[model samples]
Target: MKARVTVMLKNGVLDPQGEAVRHALGALGFDGVEGVRQGKVIELDLVQGTSQATVKEMCDKLLANAVIESYTIEMA
Candidate 1:
């Protein structure tokens, strides 16, 4: 089994890294971009039959900071 997790800052949170990327893009002449929000993707290899609930538990425990970040899980 495999799972992919995406973690991102919640709306209304400050994202300095994302802002920096937007600024850099403008400087590099890709001016159409108006905003950027940075996030992370984590791929996990798990034992067969691993459940999405288990993956969610992992996110709740460590993969994401519940107060400021949210995560989505995709299992394969």
Candidate 2:
């Protein structure tokens, strides 16, 4: 089984890295972008029976910071 986790800053959190990227894009001539939010993707390869709930536990315990970030899990 494969599990993919996406971690992103919650709304109202400051995202300096994302802001930097947005500014860089405009400086590079790619205008019209008003905002940018940065996030991470983590792919895990597990045993055949690994469940989504198990993955969510991993996210809750280690992969994401519950105070400032949120995560979503996809299984395949």
Per-candidate TM-scores read 0.98, 0.97
Instruction: Give candidate 2's whole-model lDDT.
Output: 0.97
Model 2 C-alpha lDDT per residue in residues 24-53, reported as the tens digit of each score? 999999989999999999999999998899
- Residue lDDT tens for model 1, 1-76: 8999999999999999999999999999997998999999999999999999999999999999999999999998
- Against the reference, the lDDT scores of all candidates come to 0.97, 0.97
lDDT of the structure predicted as candidate 1: 0.97
Which whole-number lDDT from 0 to 100 does residue 65 have in model 2? 100
